[model samples]
Target chain A: MNGYLLAGTITGVVVGLVIAAVAMTFTKKNRKEKFTYDERQKTARGEGYKYAFFTLVIYNAAYGIIDMSLTKPWTENMTGMMIGVCLAILVHVVYCIWHECYFSMNEEPVKVLAFFGIISVINVIIAVIQGLHGELIENGMLTNNCANLIVAVMFGVILFALAVKGYVKKEAAEEEE
Target chain B: MKNLKLKAARAAMDLSQQELAGRVGVSRQTINAIEKGDYNPTINLCIAICRVLGKTLDELFWEE
Candidate 1:
């Protein structure tokens, strides 16, 4: 019921919407109007969804157990939930990227990569600002600001995986040639 | 169980994996995976590939 927490949530939602709009704009400009995944990519993405679903389920169960056992949990309920969501997203993204199914046939990966990079940078900046303001943690438990950091880390890991996979594919093609 | 027959047919047609994949509306990696035995595509895709190469299913996909 804290006014500051409500305000922070609103701000986060607004920022997220703005970033999504920007990403969509870039996608519209660079990609085909009809986005589609090939059959193999679709199959791979289905597996990714399965793994990500299990990840979220397991994370939520563990979080529930830990929260119940502790008198004071390390994060708010919403923040803990967000962490699980981020973990699921990371798993799905990494799996899809590894299997060469993350980007659809008509999707411009450069635009998607740029969007992720921008999101990571923005979340990191927000987390740092909140940390400086002594809002990242309160009473020895991580606050919602920690969720921003977790999201940044999630996107960062995705970006790194994408880069590494791209490099490996390029090297493989060269060797084959 | 690499699809050597498919690869041979594709090569005889002078088509790169990417070119064949495009004609079949799939990604190059999918074609590579098929030829490398890393992926077993669906019947629809197999038919599509066969149709593109002007080969029958038995010619490209049958294993003796």
Candidate 2:
């Protein structure tokens, strides 16, 4: 890599870390009003965690086996690990959403949904830019640039699930009325 | 079996599931699940519901 590019990357990462730290501090300050899950929701969340853990274990095992058996790995280490983590997160989110335990007492669903929407859009844009640059794949193998694409897809799936669940509930409510 | 007694009690109080759940510090979905026989809440939650609805354990949650 060019020396100037390496320096610029390092500088950008450092600035990003500072911004993230500031955001965390602001969030912590605003979170003084704590929201808690009720018993049933807590139990459902626990089950979600269990399922997510199992997903992570199963995904990692399969990924490891595939990587070892293949002559060339499809993904780099960071990307492969991120895929597993995202899968686990997707499972957990879907389970919690299905069980109606995803949102706590004081949390606004619209805000959470908007947050996910923004994250999905940002990731999708980054992935698209990388794809256009021919960075998402190299030598017939998936590159680390695909990580953003995977994240975009994960959030997209979550948004889709939430929408579907909301639609189902609306239909059920209309039927009951 | 569905806890029709709990549903009746909640209804008698003129409280919607959302209102009752708010009073009992739970989600409406939890109350709906309990009423629908889909979820068996903990004893604490049952007690909370009973207290909110002015019912006893035997009145609301006990199997007939």
Candidate 3:
């Protein structure tokens, strides 16, 4: 179990590093057309984080109460780690939705919401499966962690493709007009 | 379909999409999408674009 936990933590760190590297590379390559987050964008991002944090706190409290009532031997670290990962993911999703909806003038809320909803559902399903199988390791990894990561990457890719397609179609129409 | 006469007129003014977008206080990508008819700008944005290009709302955005 300890080995599993250590391995999971290492895997998570590696994944995080890879994602950071990719983002850094993209920003470096696109220096001329950098993505800017203005005051409004910052506010939106902050608000999303606030919402995620408050929800996570409430959820943790509820879960603690339930665990205590059931007299289940749950460790504080385990509960905190699980809740933290969930909150972090929720924050990311909320930030994406808020940025797409408010900051991007060309984006439609419906499309953004739909994409977020689909990704949230998929994540929930993965979480439930991991929970049922008791596959989540102490170090923040699961047996299906690879699947979760793949789904997350695919979600981003799909949204990017959709945005490109929408932008292209809109551009062509403007030319005709 | 909404007519993109405003974008066309802006193009006719020898203005690049980036230049027009700057004049209208929007991103170049927004202007490109608008010109490509991929996005529908808000009435305020439309008016701003029309004003920048010396055109009226009716002239730039009529529905077919």
Candidate 4:
């Protein structure tokens, strides 16, 4: 077993699950609220995104510089890509959780879960089909190990869309008025 | 910058932030934010809060 791939896969999946668990813990099933954004949540989320954005920018740049300057073949540290992405997400999660606005932003937690859950199932199906055809396994048990990271990217895009929608709701409302 | 007037109104009506938020079909945090003046509610939301608080928009939102 390749240690780098093992570590990379574990880092991505563990972080993704931790985020999911934390997000789900904030759901209010009985509250029956349609939209979760209020005044403060929108502000907090905006600020969180701002910080997360800059954090990732610097992180990615630093990672690239360090990877090229410090590593042997540049791909020697897959963690450059894998760990960097996870840490970007970690920054946003930590910021949101700190502000107590994580729950408010992830208003439709069930919808998010369902959407990603279906995609996850589909990824598995593709993996199985590819595995049967002898495609997914490049070396042995460590190839194509970034599946969780791929899912996380998709999930993050949808969540970003929701945040954008939430941020613009008031403006949209005013325009309609 | 808390909207003490709105808070006072809610208190006068013997309602908690959670109750008002529930009645307005919003989260308690929304109500809390509104009372704290940290978030500006939309006109629709302002109207909703007003309706729930038994006050006009001016009474609750307009700062005199």
In order, the Cα lDDT scores of the candidates are 0.89, 0.85, 0.60, 0.66
Descending-lDDT candidate ranking:
1, 2, 4, 3
Scoring only the A-chain of each prediction against the true A-chain gives TM-scores of 0.91, 0.84, 0.50, 0.44
Q: Write the per-residue lDDT of candidate 1 for residues A1-177, one digit (tens) a residue.
A: 499888978988898899877676676534446667898899999999999999999999999999999998888778888989989999999999999998877767888998899889988998889899998889988777687899889999999999999999999889977
lDDT tens per residue, model 3, B1-64:
4345765797689998768876876766566556656567778888888889898888888764
Best by TM-score: 1
lDDT of 4 by residue, A1-177 (tens): 378767866886786688667545545454444336656666777888888788779988987786679534343244346556656666676566555466663365565556556656665665566667765444433245445444455455545655665556557557745
Candidate 2 stretches greater than 4 Å from native = A1-31
**Quick one: how many clashes does candidate 1 have?**
0
Regions of candidate 4 where Cα sits further than 4 Å from its true position: A1-35, A71-76, A105-177
* Lowest lDDT block of 10, candidate 3 chain A: A98-107
Q: Give candidate 3's chain B TM-score.
A: 0.85
TM-score list, all predictions: 0.91, 0.87, 0.46, 0.57
* lDDT for residue A89 in candidate 3, whole number 0-100: 54
Ranked by TM-score from best down, the candidates are: 1, 2, 4, 3
Docking class of 1: medium
Error of 3 at A166 (Å): 7.3
Question: How would the candidate models be sorted by DockQ, starting from the highest?
Answer: 2, 1, 4, 3
True contacts kept of each: 0.71, 0.86, 0.00, 0.43
Candidate 1, TM-score of its B chain = 0.97
- Model 1 chain A lDDT-worst window of ten: A25-34
Per-residue lDDT tens digits of candidate 3, residues A103-124?
Answer: 3433334545464456646756
Q: Write the per-residue lDDT of candidate 1 for residues B1-64, one digit (tens) a residue.
A: 8889999999999999989988999988899999989999999999999899999999998899
lDDT-superior candidate, 2 or 4 = 2
